[model samples]
Target: MNPVDKNHWLDGLEASVERHLQHAIYYFQNQDSEVLLKPSVTGGWSIAQCLEHLNRYGHFYLPAIDRALQRHDGQPDAPTFTSTWLGSYFTRMMQPETGKWKIKAMKAYAPPPNLDAHAIVAEFIHQQETLLALLSRARRADLTATRVPISIATFIRLRLGDVFAFLIAHDERHIQQALRNLPVSQDIDVQAVR
Candidate 1:
């Protein structure tokens, strides 16, 4: 990915987070547990499973980001964020554009067959709220200098900006998948989900 203005990048990510939060509130939160737990027509994960999967990721990345930010040395925020090669690769891989190859969730990240939809949706909303607050706090830290370890591979750390980009992209991918699992009658405007 090309370099982008730091504030611009953060603002875009914040907007994405807000959209996800609203989708959970307006759509998922109101759905019946049976609807959320129904198996996908395509033999994929159910809506509740998708959300629980994302919540699992949030369980890892959110605190990782918070800790990285807390440890920041009070350096001035960078004017621009340049994605590292690996970071860009991961972000692009996570995007849910049509025809993209699906990546299987690692065993640890996979959601169980039966989950309570209400709890999963509530947890997702709470995590997004936490993420929004963290993003606000991030404006004071150096995006490039601060590093967050990846959940899959803790030994490898990426620039904080890249972690934000990759994490949001992953969220969007799964949320889109969750939307697909919805009954056609309850279908949201697909574009709005993005």
Candidate 2:
């Protein structure tokens, strides 16, 4: 994509991050630990667990994105970004629209039992803000030229645009999961067994 198009996409992604952050903050502030930490009857993840999973991804991608952007600092600007086939495929797989399609989390990304809800929420909020900053830095770089490796295999790299797409889509997916896990009632009174 051209500079204009890339910027427009980043704008939308940043806005989505901001919106997710707001909802997360609202849930964390308004809801108690009982609601946030309650697991599903089928042994699925809780709201805190979902946020922690996203945080695990952020831990990998945020630093990698920062390094990728830095590498493009003195390079000549490219007119357009072309997504790699593998990158595009991964991004498509992670999109929020596919939330109904259940995919098990990698072992490294799974949150443990009895996690601290406040800490997980705080980290997720901070990570979203950091992601927004990274998006701003991305605009200055050539999205097609900058490459970041995935967490599972550091040797494999993808274009910056695809990384952004994957990360944002991944964020949305988990946000949806967390939202679904939330208690409908404001006055939550469940004592969920771990």
Candidate 3:
């Protein structure tokens, strides 16, 4: 991937986080437990499961990001962020638009059936807020120099900017999956929600 201005990159990511947060507030919060737990017509995971899955990831990445930021506290922010080859590969694989292959979730991250809709939605909202704050804090740190370990493999780490990119893309992928599981009668306007 080409180098991107740090501020511009963060701004785009922040906007994405805001949209996800708003959707959780306006849409998911309004749904009843039954609707939220309803499985897709093709027999996929429920909305609640999708969210819980994301929440599980947030449980790992959020703290990892915080720790990385703290460890690199005095570092200077770079003018631009250039994604590493591996980082770019991971980000592209997580993106819903570019990622056509459906990868199975790790056993730990896979959410089971019968999750509480309200709690899942609430946690998701909290995590999104936390992500926003971290993104803001990241302005003071060097995106290229900082590294965060991937949940799947602790020994391997990616640039802070790549972590943000892939993590948000993963969130979007599942959120869209969750939206698909929504009942047709609910008449959700996905575009307008953002």
| TM agreement with the true structure for every prediction | 0.95, 0.88, 0.96
Weakest ten-residue segment in model 1 by summed lDDT: 95-104
User: lDDT of each structure?
Assistant: 0.89, 0.80, 0.91
1 against 2, candidate with superior lDDT: 1
Ranking by lDDT: 3, 1, 2
Judge candidate 1 against the unseen true structure and give its global Cα lDDT, from 0 to 1. Answer: 0.89
Q: Pick the candidate with the highest lDDT.
A: 3
**Residue 115, candidate 2: C-alpha displacement in angstroms:** 0.5
User: What tens digits encode model 2's per-residue C-alpha lDDT throughout 1-194?
Assistant: 32446777778888878877887787664568888799965688888888999999999999999988887898876655687778777877888655456788889998896988888899999999999999887778888878899898999998888898889888887777677676666423222210
Candidate 3 Cα errors over 4 Å, as ranges: 189-194
Candidate 1 residue lDDT tens string, 1-194: 57788888899999999999988888899999999999899899999999999999999999999999988857667788888999888888997773299788899999988998899999999999999999998888888889999998899999999899889989998888888888988877777656
Q: Which pairs clash (backbone N, Cα, C closer than 3 Å) in model 2? A: 1-81
